[model samples]
Target: MLGSISLDKTTRRVSLRAKALMIFSILLAPGCLGSDEEIDVFYGEDIVPPRATPDFVLFDQNGDPVAFNDYLGDVVVVAFLFTRCPDVCPQVSANMAWIGNELGDNLGTEVHLLSITVDPWYDNSSVMQNYAYDRGLEWPHLSSDLETMEPIWRSFDVGLETYANDTDGDGTVDGFDLCPDTPEGEQTDADGCGVETQQSEGDVQTMHHPLYYIDHTTGTIIVDRAGNQRVYWGDFVWNADMVLDDIMALVEESA
Candidate 1:
């Protein structure tokens, strides 16, 4: 596990924990911190600096346009993944869902979660909504046309997932998982779409807005109120408890 201060934008990072690949696991060096402090675990590809974030607008799952700057005053945890992600993508989003639940009432008030789709050509509005609803996510799951999202992807160095899978056991793959979050014990049609209404539909979704090519490349960026990109977690750092600790510490420090 590796953790350290990020000096500049080109800081290459690597996780200090083991990463799960397919059904096997790869043990790695541990680098988690008991307290919240600036730590860099980047292996390569230099750490992207805490520079001024450019403003970009995209339709969320609910099909509403939102500006990134609008989230400045809140603690925002952003991840790059598509609903059809087979392995790490679902794992990363599931981690965020865990965090969102743990945040309790502070979810929308003090903190927010952002999942941006790297695959736009297929992950349209409906697919985005199903992805979040199935994951018990209360945050905005975003995506857009490739032309609109190209720069956004490049800006954040988020790898595009040109493909997808049926990770939800709902029978539908990412691009076609229209009813992504079918409730457990519920029967789904030929498509993976399931009824989450009887279950928990935490937050509403928006549409047209929004990775999985690199190893342990599931990047999570925590942006503070001031928009100074604060903490950065590697692909394998999906432990909700560990992330919750770091986020809480950071929020407390900022206050």
Candidate 2:
């Protein structure tokens, strides 16, 4: 059900290796290639030859076990985010909410959404519930212990790492340092020690820093009805209308 690209002068193979090159081309010229007729190309990075998405079981905000395979029949938008992410994560979630509003009743029917946490250590069930509730996003925000979650992160190609680097010589790592450029050797509060769990405060800046950040891939992946990854939209460059078109195309294809 993935959309096709119309290229008047370009020839490219459809594979993961080719995806990078296509992304470059997409950035330069986003739509059709022909001069006379405009053809529809995916606004998001297209996975030419779609790859099967890995399946996993993770805990939702309710601490309920949800398996990826269980949602195979629906077109799922899988977004990787952390509640502690300063900016990008909330933007992606808001975009998802817009898409949900556009979907109307179809939000939970033919199409579905998932928000998986990159920082599972601090994004536990209660924290995730608060995140969803505060944002009015009624989708699964999932997490698990590192042992159970690391494999899932790898499967999804999430580039994840945690480190303690205090650039200002503060006792806290940069990830947890609210005042990253604090004057060197100046005594500060325990802000760098990390929070037990971060809640969704209105201001991203006011949120407590984690002991260390779970820096990982940032984006949403569209999975087709058969559990294959079809397209990817970077968190920062989401086009809600185009994303909806892709979802409807997949849903209509199944119909």
Candidate 3:
């Protein structure tokens, strides 16, 4: 009788487990657990709002002028970065490279990647060309003088700041930023592009930081064929698959 009771208890447990799984499946099924509006609220459908890629004229690594209007019909991924960035900039570039590789031939044809350097003072055409060659980047690397580059950077909301420091500065910070005037121990944007917006007054403050980096409220922006900003992926850490999904989504929407 003891053995029979043990078997019955085991059977009851299994039955409970099966019931739990069934309930879980029902909860996960579309239109079962929550309404469409509820799902949208939970998942955040407007995270990335589409925006237009503003028109700009910048010289590619080859010294040829490339304009936004020239690539009007193609899907473009624009990234603002500098070759001298020690942290996030390289990661962002690598992420773009991965997206291009994942897309294969679709990159040059269906999509194009544009990288604009914030350090135009040092990242001239030759410097950009060498950096692109070393990284095996097939995309365009564009830059211009500070005077010319400022307007472009401002258009994208990138801020810039410069400081003077020589404590082990040695002119180059690991080939990331060539700003020898940059002060030692000064905090900068993650990408080393420039300074932050809305500076706070300190108890003791002296110099002001110039804005150079883009304030990318939306980590990624998707511009559709109709020239309308259609998708905005705000603060979304990008990956190849996710980018592909975004492209496919836009393509399908256009179709």
Of the candidates shown, which would achieve the greatest TM-score relative to the real structure?
A: 2
Give candidate 2's error at residue 29 in angstroms.
26
- TM-score, candidate 1, is 0.60
Specify the poorest-scoring 10-residue window by lDDT in model 2: 8-17
List the candidate 3 regions with Cα displacement exceeding 4 Å: 1-49, 165-220, 229-236
Give all TM-scores, in the order shown: 0.60, 0.73, 0.59
On the 0 to 100 scale, the lDDT of residue 204 in model 3 is 31
In angstroms, how far off is 80's CA in candidate 3? 1.2
Candidate 3 lDDT by residue in tens digits, 1-255: 111124454345445544543564466587676444322111113323334557778998888898877766766667777776545677777777777766665677777778888787678999899888988887889998889887766655455664443333433232334333444555443223223322334323333332332232324455555554444443345554545555544444434
Q: What is candidate 1's lDDT per residue for 40-139, written digit by digit as tens?
A: 4222212334545577898888888878988877777888876655568888877787777766666887788888887776688788988877767767
RMSD of each: 13.9, 10.2, 14.9
Write the number of the candidate with greater TM-score, choosing between 1 and 2: 2
